[model samples]
Target: MAKLHIAMYPWYSFGHMIPYVHLANELAARGHRISIFVSKKAHSKLQSHNLHPHLITFITITIPKVDGLPEGTETGHDVPMELNHLLCDAMLLTRQQVEEILTADKPNFVFHDLAFWIPQVTKKLGIKSVCFLVISATCMASGIKPFREVTDDKPLTEEELTTPPPGYPSATVVLTLDEIMSLLGASDFSGMTKLHEGFTTSMSDCDVLAIRSCTELEGKFCDYIQAHYKKPLLLTGHVLPEESESKLEQRWADWLQGFEPGSVLYCAFGSQYVLEKDQFQELVLGFELTGLPFFIALKPPVGCTNIEEALPEGLEERVKGRGVVHGGWVQQTLFLSHPSVGCFVSHCGFGSMWESLVSDKQIVLVPHLGDQIINTRLLSTDLKVAVEVKREKNRWFSKESLNEAIKSVMDKDSEVAILLKKNHLELREKLIKPGFSSGYVDRFVQSLEELAN
Candidate 1:
């Protein structure tokens, strides 16, 4: 294949940027030149993920300041979910900047997410604009469907969301009352545009559509999206590095070494979402109830300044030796790769979901967002490789439910546990078979090449 120059414009969150970097690396390794756009701050953090720095360029995006955001707040890390729209509005403010860059640089293709207007700029500049969604096809098919375009301003009622959107693939993916209420709380994407508008418009107008998923994993959903969008929808097949180069931090390595192989549990929600104080307490307390050693790394919960400050009384002392509730970041791959970590409790973010699937660790999900909820259902229901922690009517997971999900998997001899283990291994092997991911990347690049010509 001839060398291709591609531009990547991912959303400002690490969840979005990191996957774009992975794809950039994949393209770069195959002798393609890549330019990735992110804010200066996000670029600083994302620098390490770029494996082929020589072939891949990081272009700093200048985020225009908005009223509600702190003077220098360019990404979501600096703000709460309630204040995220300001950042979204700020990201949209860069339409001129993005337009200028694409016009001048003139890459063959520009892969973007959430910036609905990029397609217009790319089309004007004779560039192939691919809306490379880092989310699952399941979420895309269910949320943004083949039917009418849902406007940004309409508020969805519980009745509307509890059932899947029109022409959605399956009955297995309906939302719970709790999920519906949570969606209502978090629906607005600020004064600029809603996520539905961004996704639908981006998909509808783009020259090509690509998803960071595979037909092997979400075949029906992928097919549905392509058939409806009537565009060149390419699957990037979980564009992740073959191996993590970073080492396990010494502190984590030492602590994990104390436990027997496949004995400890490692729980983490991704950086963006934090559990409520009560739910956080229940989670750690549930670990204590397991009577097994666990390492849980999470940000401080609501109303608390630190993990220790939020713990239930006497619970820390009771589980001191066996449990660690760290409030800082840990290298998740190292934790998952460790022999002692037998079970993983995750939030089922797209990235976390893939890591969970590729590892031997038993899976337990506690999803918080819309995409996460669908991802959890996919893993727990269709794949049957994992189990989801049951949520109460109020949408909080209790210590008992947490303990029960872990126990259901940790008890290897039990029928349910055995079934999950067997199914997980089978699926993992099939997905990661030699050339599986790279093959998809190759085909994705070819599709973009065809579109570019």
Candidate 2:
């Protein structure tokens, strides 16, 4: 086999960027040359991770300013909820720059995430292009019908939007009308339209499709996508990063050390979601009801300077010695792998879900937005490895409901807990099987090499 040079562009969000970096590392380890193009702000975030300097190159693209987007916001995760579309619009503006760089570099192949314009440019340059999905196969599979059927002029009917797409599995999870409306409403509805356009164009123009999923976990969904699209689909197993040896900061580490092994619950919503003060208060009360030691890492809600201000008065003291609230950044993977951590109460982001799966932790899913709702449904309804916090009338959960879900998963003697633990362990074993994820990466590299030839 000959060494190949590949160019990669992912959506600006860290969730998308980090997986692309992981794939790049895997390819580089196999002796390939790789270039990753990202916005300047995104490049700064990537710098914190140890990437292969020799085999991988980081090319920074400037995000053009757009109305509603703050000056420094480069990714969806960095901005307020309503401004996400501006980030997408700004990314679209970089098409010209991306083309110029790719044209000069003249890489044999280009892998892109959600940048629909790339295929047109790559086509003109005669470079092979692959559309990379940074989300779950089930979610992607669910979208196939809508993307094919819905058009800019002919919008999806309310029923079409609410119902599962045709050919989706009978048990396929569909987002509620309210959840869909909330997702679109957050970005003023235009964001979803842009995304629909992007997916439609990219799927039509790309040479192949690649998704970050494994057959062991989502084989049926993967097969459905391949059969539906009539295109070659690559399943690049969940590319988990190597565990970090670095310990948490002294304060957090010392606090977690007080809990018995596998006795504490760790709660974290990924960096993107912000909770309302009322919702934050409910979560605090729910944790208090659990009576088990726990730690939560969250951003202070709007108008609050710190977690203490956002939390109910003296709630921290009430749960003193049993609960630790850390604001700002947390070493999530480290905490998930920590010996003292027993359960994870999470927003069910794909990255967080993968980390939980890799760590084999009991999960209490509380999906907040976007594909998280679908991911939660898949985990709880299809996989049955995690339990979802019960929602009231299909809306956000009450504190009592949250507490019940937590206690249900944490109780070792309960049948439901036993089953969840069994499933978690079984999944961990499957994922760790020799060459499980590596094999998928190897095959994907081989396909790219073939295209390069």
Candidate 3:
């Protein structure tokens, strides 16, 4: 296949951009020219991940300020979920920037997510637009359909969302009522279509549809998408993070080394999603109850300036030697590979889900809307590679539920522990098999070439 130039513009959040860069690196490594649209600050953080800098380039785009958005907000990470639509508004305003770049560069393809109107832009320019989703295919399947099929303005209701859409894969588990509610309310930003409609429009408008996932893991979901939408689809595998020459920070390495191998728990939610103070304390209290050495790299609770202020009154002192809580980012990939880190307690974002899947650790997921689809799939009886913390009717979990979920995987003698560990290890081995991810990339590139042809 001839070398192609692919321009990617993922959502402004760090989680979304980082995964795009991972895929960009894979494509660049395959001798393709790649250009990524990013804000200067986001590019600053992503610079180190550009392994093939000679082939990959960054195109700057401006984020227009919306009324509710803070003055300097260039990414969704800077704001609470309630204000994300404002970010989306800002993303839409970059249409001129995107079109000018596309007009100037005349790339073979432009890959996008979050820009639901991207198809409208590419169609006019006669560029092949790929809606390469950063979210799971399952999420796409249930929430989206052909944009032309919708004849009414009514949004998908909670009841409809809780069950798989017609022609969806026969997965035994569907979204819980709470998750469905979260989804319905997530995009409450005025002047925007509902989240489900947005996804439907995105997939419907694209020339080629691709997911940051693999057939081995989500083949049925991918099939459902291709058949349902009648659009050519591609999978980029998990686009696993490239191995880093950087090591874990010295302080964290020393602390983790003191624990027995596979004994400590590492917990992190991605950059977004701040817990309420009560919930943050509940989460820490749960970690404390586990009595296992743990490191928590999460944002401070809402209403607090930092993690230190949000820590429960005595949590630090009680877990003094065994626990540390930090608010800022850390080397998540390197920490996951550490020998002493035995288990992963994740907020279950797509990137984290893939990271956890590729690790040897026991998996425990606490799903927010961001990953409810994939998280449910992993914990379903069909796969059973991980366990989920039980939540109350209001979708809140007690410290005990959190504690037990961790300890369930920690206890070697328990039947559930044995099953989870066995299944997780076997699956991880399969996913990381030599060429598993790269093979997907190869086929994905072929699909792109076919589209261009």
Candidate 4:
């Protein structure tokens, strides 16, 4: 066997980019060469992690300015929801720079995130390409089935929208009307259509499909995807970084130290989700009602400068000593792994889910958008390791609902709490034990090597 040179490109979101970095580092540790293509902004974040210099190299590419996009918007996290489509459109412009790198480097294989056009470029250059899915296997399987089988442009009927996609009989995950409307109404329909087409073409044309999940957790969904796509699929496990000792900020450390062991609730929506004023207030009131110590990191809604302005007046003072609210970055892993943290109230992004799972924390899900809704279903319905907040008719949850859900998870005698605790412990044992994630990465790299040869 010979060492292989690989090229990797991920979508401009941190959720997408960080997982790819985990995979690249794993491959590099196994003595392979990996070149990562990222924007200057993303490259700076990657460099901050201080990745292995010898085996992994990052190439910076300029994101071409689109007319409607804000100046210097290079990634999904930097742009607003309405302008996300323009970001996607801007990525297409990078094809020339990518082509130049491909021509110069001639790596054995290219691993790309859902930028559908990458496969076409690989095909033209006669390089093997793999489609790396950064989402759950259920979301990928469900999302692609319609694009692959349904040709009609007609909108889905109420019944059609709520049912599981064909061929996934065991899957309990289905899109609600609210979820469907959010997707259709959020951005340019044409852009979304193209993105769907990209998924189909990328899966149909790629040499392999790699997902950031394990058979232990999503075996059934993975099997369904393999049968449906009729392509070799690789499970990349969680591709999470190994837990290590790191310095925590003294202010947060001291605050967390004051709480009883495993008694604090940690709340954070990922980088992309912004809370409207009403939602923010409800969450604050809900957490305050729990009467438990909590730490929250939130992104203010558009035009709001900080969390204080977005929160209800006197809310912070009312919850004093019981809650700590920070608007900007908080080291999530440190907080999740802390001795005082018990439950994670999250947006249910895959990255956050992985972190919560490995940290052995009970999850209280408040899914806001996109695949998160599916993730919430999977976590609560399929896995039974978390409980989702009750939503009302309009899909909005009341503060009472949030408070009740948190109490249900935190109550030691409750069946939901006991079951979640049991499962969380089992999952943590599986994830943190040596070689659990690495085994999957090893097999994935071997499969890629075999394909390259």
lDDT (Cα, tens digit) per residue for candidate 4, span 188-219: 44555556665667787887888999987788
* Model 4 misplaced stretches (Cα beyond 4 Å): 148-160, 169-171, 181-185
Q: Which lDDT tens digits does candidate 3 get at residues 1-453?
A: 699999999888887898899988888888999999999879888998899999999888878878989999987678766566677778888889988888888889999887888889888888998988888877677665332322358654545446667776756656665565465335442322345565677788898889988877778878988997798888899987668788889988888989999999999988777888998999999999999999999988889998888888877789999998889999998889999998889887888888888989988888876555455565545578888888877687999999998998899999999998888788888899999988989999888887887
Compute each candidate's TM-score over C-alphas: 0.93, 0.94, 0.92, 0.93
Residues 317-427, candidate 1: write the lDDT tens digits.
Answer: 788778898999998988999999999999999999999998999999998865788899998988899999998877778889999999999997989899999999998
User: What ranges in model 3 sit over 4 Å off?
Assistant: 145-157, 184-193
Best model per lDDT: 1
Evaluate model 1: give its TM-score: 0.93
Residue 329 Cα positional deviation in candidate 1, in Å, after optimal superposition: 2.0
Q: lDDT of all predictions, in order shown?
A: 0.84, 0.82, 0.82, 0.83
**Lowest summed lDDT over 10 consecutive residues: which window, candidate 4?**
181-190
**lDDT score, residue 226, model 1?**
91
Candidate 2 per-residue C-alpha lDDT over 222-329 given as tens digits, one digit per residue, 9 for 90 to 100: 898888778888878888877677878788788888879999989999886778888888888899888999888898877788887888888877987798787889
Which structure is stronger by lDDT: 3 or 4?
4
